[model samples]
Target: MEREKVIEVRDLVKKFGAFTANDHLSFDVYRGEIFGFLGANGAGKTTAIRILCGLSRPTSGRVMVAGIDASRRPEEIKKRIGYMSQRFSLYEDLTVRENIELYGGIYGMRMKELIHRREAMLQRLSFTSYGDTLIRSLPLGLRQKLSFATAVFHDPEIVFLDEPTSGVDPVTRRQFWEMIYETASQGITVFVTTHYMDEAEYCDRITIMNEGKIVALDTPSVLRQQYGTATVEELFVKITRPQRTMV
Candidate 1:
């Protein structure tokens, strides 16, 4: 079966004065995909992501996210997607339920529907007892899970996770990926950026960026085989840091 394209980019470019952050990039993200956007520091993947999220405008070329023209209608694009940053973008002083209500409102969900979904989400997270607990009181892993849940409160067509599992314990990270898989199984496109190579392997397909351009893009297993590397970590190092790779 032919997959539907949810995001389409062609010759996308974003420049900052004398420097170019994204350089003529082009890629397609399909519906229900777990697309990994990988890169080392200063690779311009962040810039590209911001553009795709409609948080920033691309300098040139076509960029469509969820069928909206990201460059021309950034605000409209925002309504169609969800974003969870590494910081877990939650109110430290707010109780878990309050924070969920806040984000649900921001996503334009109806009050009654928000309350219903919020309760269901808490139940699913095994967080029924933590509704009144302040976000600051919860552990990092729990807070991260809440952030993911709130980000998708409106059930967006796509979700952008920027290092969503960073700095968590291995078990917590595994649990987080399970949520990601469940989200994708429901046909929501998961666009994640992670530095952990093991997490990269969990993605259905990944595109590696270097120096503002894509250097490698494929399934983790295919990338490993094509690069003659046993692991995605080795493949990442080989592509992004050739100087550290030995012949």
Candidate 2:
């Protein structure tokens, strides 16, 4: 049986003036899998995600997300993806329920469906008790969970999480990954970028980017075997250190 490709990129490029942020990148993310995007800062992970999410235009090359051509039909693609950025975008002053409602409305979900899904999300996160609490009042971990729940309120086919666990505590990070696993189990493709090496191991497969291009892509175990390293961190160091030596 052939799995459907939820995301497809070919020769994708993103340039800013004299700098190229993404240089002819290409990859495919299968449906219902967690695809990890790994790279050091300025490695173009976010740039590639932005283009795929229809948040930015690629400078050149073919890009398809959720079966829609990004360059020619970004608006259509936007409806199929949920994006959670590094910065939690929920309105701090709004209550938890309010924030969820706001995003549901933006996605044009019916009030009835929004209400039902909101309750289910709260139950899943064990956050029903905090439904009326202001988002600012919740602890950071809970807020992060809420932000993720809000992003997928519309049941998007794929979710883009750009450093969603950055600055979160170890316990909270574990909890967040639990949510991610649950989401993937429900058949939502999770495309996430993270700097944490251990978290990279959690992905079904990972792609390592260097200098705006994909330098490595494979299962975490395969990557470790190929690099003769015990961990993703070591592999990252091995791949990136040579680049540093040149400078």
* Winning model by TM-score: 1
**62-152, model 2: which lDDT tens digit per residue?**
9989989999999999899999998889999999999999989999989999899999989978899999999888989888888888878
Instruction: List clashing residue pairs in candidate 2.
Output: none
Per-residue lDDT of candidate 1, residues 1-247 (tens digit):
8889999999999999989889889999999999999999888877888899998999999999999999899999999899997566799999999999998898878999999999999999999999999999999999999899888888999999998988899999999999999999999999999999999999999999999998988899999999999989999999988987876
Give the CA lDDT, 0 to 100, for residue 153 in model 1: 82
Q: In model 1, which regions exceed 4 Å deviation?
A: none
Candidate 2 has what TM-score? 0.96
Error of 1 at 60 (Å): 0.8
Q: Show the colliding residue pairs in model 1.
A: none
Backbone clash tally for model 2? 0
Per model, how many backbone clashes are there? 0, 0
